[model samples]
Target: MATDGPNLASTYEYVIVGGGIGGITLAARLHARLPEASILVLEAGSDPSTHELATSASTVSAVRSNADLTWQLPIEPCKGLGNRSSIAQVGKGLSGSGAVNSAAWTRGPACDYDLWAHSVGDQGWSYESLLPYFKATECVRGMKINEDHHGYEGLIHVVPVKANWAKRTYPLRKAVQEAWAQSGVDYIEDGNAGDPLGLTELVEAWDEGKRQLPSKSFDLEGVDIVTDTLVHRVTFTQDQGHEPRAKGVELISGQHINATKEVIVSAGVYHTPKILILSGIGDPQTLVAHSIPLVHGNPEVGNNLRDHLSVALTWKLKHPEIGLALGSPLLTDPSYANGAPLDFIQFGRVPTNLHTEMLLTSKEDKALVLRPKACHTESILLYTYMGPHMSGVNVPMDGTYITTVTANLAPTSRGHVSIHSKDPQQPPKIDVNANDTEVDRHILREGLRNISKVLHETPSGQSFIDSQVPPEGYPVLLPDSKDEAYDVRIRDFGFTLDHPMGTAAMGKVVDASCRVIGVNGLRVVDASVFPVPIAAHIQVAVYALAARAADLIAKEQ
Candidate 1:
């Protein structure tokens, strides 16, 4: 069962590389549709069932830190980010990042999808076109859900912060809501229901409190799941004046598996492009630089990389005995031990126009950001002192502080995922240009300023926040802080939100059908194919996307 896929057939109907979320989910659905078809899934990571730390929210860092379970790739220094280098890591297990990420099941605004369709020149990628797939993927049980937009019959279960029966509450739940409202952000019933702006209850892809692994949730009972197997590159059968046809994949260990029908690559953002490039199907210049033989030359294969970047503000609470933070007596209760600590996520545009700000953004990118119903910022309220610390504020083991990590959801800064070697075993060169554009910097600065104003001036804020832990040389923020101060802060300490995509974008590399251009019998179905940045945590979108890809693949057959 481990060696042979679907049967003992030497050639499979579908050969899937990287048994991560997208690969596993697609295989499960395809198997359900065509029970007799031969499908092979190759994963370079361990089986998630044996990964003990993947079940709960508390061990997320432990899972990511486990070298055996994750690919901790070093990022190249970005000049835009004050020349600071950071890590770009993701899960290497069968479930991939879905097994390691904080399981927030959020769907970005409908406009995000609509804009993607417009950019990619395909109506099928629109929100209305993809709505059925979204409904097909989730069994939403939130308290205030609109039945018209949610589905009760799906594999993954979604629960909002105001969930009726889940029986869990945070100490700062009500206060945090009131404080954000005091800052003029309104309440929205369901953020997943097309409208993503304003403050909304936090939601998660949860089972009571346990994390849901995609490899387990989608039901791949009889499918062959090969683990710890690295795919080196795709072997193709090509002829002159014809698109190269993918024959099969060659493993890094020099083992080759034949694919009779198609080869699907879902190795994710960081590694997917590396596989394509290693297959000699990328930019001519890059191939020449790495001394790889060129089969198909497309410059966009590993370009246009983007991710969510954030700057966090830490607030020292007045009363530690109240037990509002983590490490408090409140966590002793079993209900509080599961899922994420925060209760709500606040999203909105920058408070003011950037007329006074310096020149920023390409004309096309700027228009989409300023478009109607597109949110530019997301503020995550962590119930503990999880610091993106500028001052490096340290507290006791007691609960005395909380953090707000406000991220630029629609960043204009673009980076690339390039390779310096011909070997796929070596990780790709990842350069994330954080806070590079003036537009990105302006949005983040104003977002921090807005939240800071809320905690510093609002009546509700006075109830909970004692004071902000300041950066060095400043006793307080606002009056002392300047444009250069925050710019310096962002360059010094801005961190990636760990959501990377668009390396193999739809409009550039693949068509709307997810088929790679200038090649046949090869498709990429993963977050790397996302043409634009979706403004929410990508967990829900990825699950729903694989469902869409499976449907498209099945219909073609």
Candidate 2:
């Protein structure tokens, strides 16, 4: 809803910036607990509930390409990816990335959250501690959900692709499963139970084929939602002999909205730190460079940025009818071949000979290398068309190609997000620094090699593959190509899985309760508060985190 002058003049008990997944969820939870409390939400983009692209489950491409629904931010040229600059697509509306993402509702392994809790020295953040919240956010449908693992009463609906639909759409489902089994990968009964080691049908946050946006799923009754508004910076006040307390927020229009109780910043990874930096709550050096006076010297505000660096390997299908062509009604499952369940995406591995060779050639630090205890690589098969549409090859209508996207799940390489100027309208400088370390490159190279091997050597995989279709401007690596060739290929084609996080990290920028360090009455509740990147699709985690944050905030109040 549009905000008027009168709305801006009124003060609220709680002010939430960004109206995205975390912000909306927190607002709904707070309202449910304290029905008399007044809450205000400021969103930079239009409401996704009314937008067609945001609500359509089949229009995945449209959500990514639509300029109006996404913040078309560009990353700074990275030496890791051959000094190439690429667009970082962050959602711009009320639903945020949840509205635009591929709708894969897989929660990562339990070990990932346990590791996170250990890293931050907080038992409350552990998987077991947060399991109730995870269950509280979703109502599983269309499948027999384990009562011990899933919730029966929740707003968001989670469901598996129907068996009839999967059978009709994926003619090669059985063959693919057999092929994966032949390659030594087992079938996971349910990926969400936290053991995602094998092939499992993906559950999506969809109801009746329509995207269930977080904004719509969460009840926003009695909440004042201000859409098409940009939050310039948070306002803070310091009384005599008292700590600096957050007053509210100032808009780009120079209007002030007062928050009598607290201000919660949930502007996402890229913009959450951007807002904090703009408010002078960043590194003193960065603030001085941008002529922004330092309010607090939290050097870790925008550092430790992490994301899944991915490269796609495409192949031509000999039997087009077996592929997900003709706008298939369902996409069955994606599997992880050889890695821990904590690894975010599904992946396949190469033969033992190639695997040994790749490991022998590696010269990275032993600590950085992924061992059996830690997950390094991840992969997932895409049945539908991928790559540039203008290339004329691998078109959805043509039904000739399938793609496998491989990635480094637990990357040691780190980057930062900083502002060039004090203007919030200008996008932040996001440098993921992908493949900056030898270990990251090694993992990605091996991942690509393994996926290629599965498609070429496996009986079921080979039966469907006619040939490999390299994207234009990419070199086709021979089966006997050197390891350097695979490295070069990864550098040339790598992109983010679009899961950017760990900017305002926990235990550094914020405390265990998500309250910002060195500040009172202000908190950051979003992916930015993640101390480390969780190895999975992040939406489910975000929902669970927000649910936990709401409880913490409510208890303290």
Per-residue C-alpha lDDT of model 2 across residues 331-400, encoded as one tens digit per residue: 3332221111111235332232345445544332232233333455667776656755322244455567
Collision count for each candidate, in order: 0, 4
Best candidate per TM-score, number?
A: 1
RMSD of each: 2.3, 4.8
For model 1, how does the per-residue alpha-carbon lDDT over 355-455 read when each residue is reduced to its tens digit?
A: 62335446658555778788888987777777433325566546787777888898888888989788677889888877878888877877777788778
* Residue 555 miss distance in model 2 (angstroms): 0.6
How close is every model to the real structure, measured as TM-score? 0.95, 0.90
After TM-score superposition, the amount by which residue 301's alpha carbon in candidate 1 deviates from its true location, in angstroms, is 1.6
